[model samples]
Target: MNIGFDGKRAANNLTGLGNYSRSLIAQLAGFFPQNRYFVYTPKIKNHPQINRFLSIPNILTELPNVPGLFWRTSGIKKQLLKDNIDLFHGLSHEIPLGIHKSGIPSVVTIHDLIFLKFPQYFGRIDRFIYNLKFRYACKNSNRIVAISEQTKNDIIEHFNIDPEKIEVIYQSCDDSFKIASTDQLKESVRLKYQLPEKYILNVGTIETRKNLLTLVKALKQINEDHVLVVVGRKTKYADLVNQEIDKLNLRPRIIFLQDIPFNELPSIYQMAAVFVYPSVYEGFGIPVIEALYAHVPVVAATGSCLEEAGGKYSSYVSPFDHNGFAKAINHILDHPKVQKEMIEKGKDYVQRFNTEIISKEMMGLYTDVLKLHRSQHSNDAQLSTRPQRSRRSQRTSKN
Candidate 1:
């Protein structure tokens, strides 16, 4: 079987869906050596890493340089038909309409429906197009892969998709995130980023959905010597977030490291006094899993999918309750015994979400879909070969 993945967005983005695409595909290639893969990417000058994936006998097909219309490149269908791809997977929500028109079996991974859930968060044109693309993907795909049970429920409730067609495959943390030699790695990362020795860590895009304002407010109320270290790429809300920090007069205690390499993240997680992720909405919070894998005591948001990822191990807090969040942080900081227990529980909790298990489950879904499709085609072919006799004669013969 030949598999095709959308590697265009993945080659560029360092966050969220991109990381998920890269990691999941890499693990699939490693685990399923028998299947062939073709990764379709956009035409770019200096994408060198695409060549590295060739070690798995994969081919890279580049899209043309069409402005605002590159995603609809019908050339991908020509390539897929030429390459005889048995299955094509959209790692993101965007699926080329040509693929659906060509009657190909395509599966799309719907990370989340945040834009649909909160239309006010997005602008007019974006919200309009997002709903359009989301509805098309939900209605046309052969199967939908939801990263969490929460996301699957959202799909069923929001879009009227058949539950049988959706599979819940939880996302896993990066394989490199594990219990590290804290003294050495921590000091190295801390010095490199000029990080405080005793600090609470928060790693996510600083957006309204992340509930950064509540965290900033909570920081002002906490009476510890600990600083709040935020690590993520700068987004549109960076200025607004800074204003919120200034308003709280907690600028000195808030450290924002906007530019950091992915390799340094695990060590940073290890160095944290405790990791807090108070996101208001998520498909599956990957950072919570990362913190757990790093054996860091985590305080995650209560109602979101992070609860599923954190299980009974993490301290839960509301996204809007600044006082409650501060109290939880103080409780963890004060009790060394409770912190140690949480750390141990975190390690045990993350073991159930290993990449190997996730990869295997995904492969099983692929195999099952392939078999079902194959059997249907076989039955159709047999029916086509049979002679068409008169119904009355057939009924008489049966009598």
Candidate 2:
């Protein structure tokens, strides 16, 4: 089977959607080498992580023959036909316009509807464009792959799509997170980052939706000596969090890190005393899974899909409850047995989202969709070629 993917995020984005795109494509190419895979992007940039996928024998990357907005919207259909693609998958929440008219079965992965859910967080123009593109993709695509059940429900409620058409497939973290790092490697990472001896790690962009200020407030209540290490690009929301930190006099206790190399993140995850994700909402929390895969105890917020990502062993508390988060952190720190149990359970639970398992499920779905498409095409051809009665014969039969 020939498979094509919208590789914009895979080539450009460094986190979240990019990770999902690169991992999914790599796993499919590595595990099922017989199928030919093509990645179509508007342009290619110098991305080291994305570049590695090009080494796979079955995978090929293509740029738009005709550049600009035309390629992004309607010109892609011509390329898909030129390449003889059997199916096209949109790694992000959009597919090219007129793909359905071109008769190419398409699947789209809707990461989240956050722009729609929280209009205040986005600009009016951005929200309008997102709504238009997302609604069109959801309505026209042959299948939808929701990263979590929460996202799937949101799609149904907002777009009125059929539940059967959406599949809840979880995302996995990088393999580096799952592998146990040696003591030397951990020590090197610690020295490189100047990490505190004991720290609570939070990984994500600093935005209003992440609810980082609540975590900062909770830090004042905890009696432990652990620092809070935040690793991500800061937005305007960081200024608000910083003001709270200043008011509470917790500046010395919080560490903010940005632009950490991708290779060193696993070691940093392993060295943390505990991993905390206080986000108020998420499509699927990859950091929680990363913490679990790193053999660290996870404490995530309760109102969204964090529980699903963290699994049964991890603790969940309200995003607004500072006291609850502080208590959960102390409990994990104070009890060695509790930490051991969480690590064991989390390691086992994360296997469900492993690369091998997810790739196989995706391959099965693609095969089924392609088969159905071929069968429909054959039936349409037969009908078009069937004999028709003459006008006189039709009149006699009518009499």
Candidate 3:
């Protein structure tokens, strides 16, 4: 089978969506090399990661023959047919407007409906556009892949889509996060970044919904010397968090890092005393999984799908409960036995999200969708060709 994927994020983004797109495509290609994979993008970026991926024998990347603002919407329609794609998966939340008419089954992955769930974080125009595109994709795609059950439920409630149409497929982290780094590598990374000897780690975009201030508040409650290491791009909300840090006199204890190279992130996770994700919500927290795979104990907030990522072994607390977070952090820090158990259990649990497992499940979804589509297509063709007779002819035959 020839599989096509929407490769916008895989080409451009360096964050969560990019990581998911790159990882999923690589896994699928690696596990099922018998299937040819085509990654379609409106444009391309020169990144070593993308170059390495394209070097695969069975994987090819394509761009529009004619460039335009609306190329991704419909321009790729002709190319998809020219390439004879059996199926297309939109790695992000959208597919071309009328892919079904092209006779190719399509699936779209909806990461989250955060814009709808928390409208305050989005502008009116952005929200309107997101609602329009997301609803259209959910309605038109042959199937939907939600990164988490929380996202799946949100899609159903907001888009009024059939539950059966949506599949909850957890995303695996970049392969780098899962590999074990030696102590020398960890020490090198520590020296390069001037990291604190003992620090609690948090990794995600510092945004309002992520609730970074909660981490700051939680840190103020702990009497230990362990600083907080926040490694993500900061938004305007960072200013408010900085104010909170100053108000609490915890600025000296906070470390904000951005633009860390991808190769070094695993060591950062490994060197931390504990990993904390205080986000109020997520589609599925990849950082939590990254930490788990790194053999670090995780403490993330409640009120969303984080528990699913952290698994039952990790600790959780209310996003607003500074005391709860502080106590949880201290418990793990002071108790080597508890840390060992959580780390061991988390490592075991994360195996469910290993590359081979997720890739196989995705291929299974693709095969099932293809078989069903062909079966239905065959039925439709038979109905269209069935002989028709007038009422008089039918009466004469009956007589």
Give the number of the best model, judged by TM-score.
3
Deviation from truth (RMSD, Å), model 2: 1.3
After superposition, the stretches of candidate 2 with alpha carbons farther than 4 Å from their true spots are: 390-399
Each candidate's TM vs. the true structure? Answer: 0.92, 0.97, 0.98
True-structure RMSD, every candidate:
2.6, 1.3, 1.1
Which of the numbered candidates is closest to the native, going by highest lDDT?
3
Question: Local distance difference test, per candidate?
Answer: 0.81, 0.90, 0.91
Q: In each prediction, how many residue pairs overlap at the backbone (N, C-alpha, C within less than 3 A)? A: 0, 0, 0
Model 1 regions more than 4 Å off: 44-73, 98-103, 179-183, 390-399
User: Candidate 2 residues 1-399, lDDT tens each?
Assistant: 889999888878888888889889988998999999999988776867777866678989989888877787679888999999999999889988989889899999998999978889999999999999999999988899999999999999999999999988889888878898999988998988789789999999999999999899999987558999999999999999999999999999999999888888998899888899999889999999899889889999998889899988999999999999999998998898998999899889988889898899899889878888889999999999999899999999999
TM-score, candidate 3, is 0.98
What residue runs in model 3 are displaced by over 4 Å at the alpha carbon? none
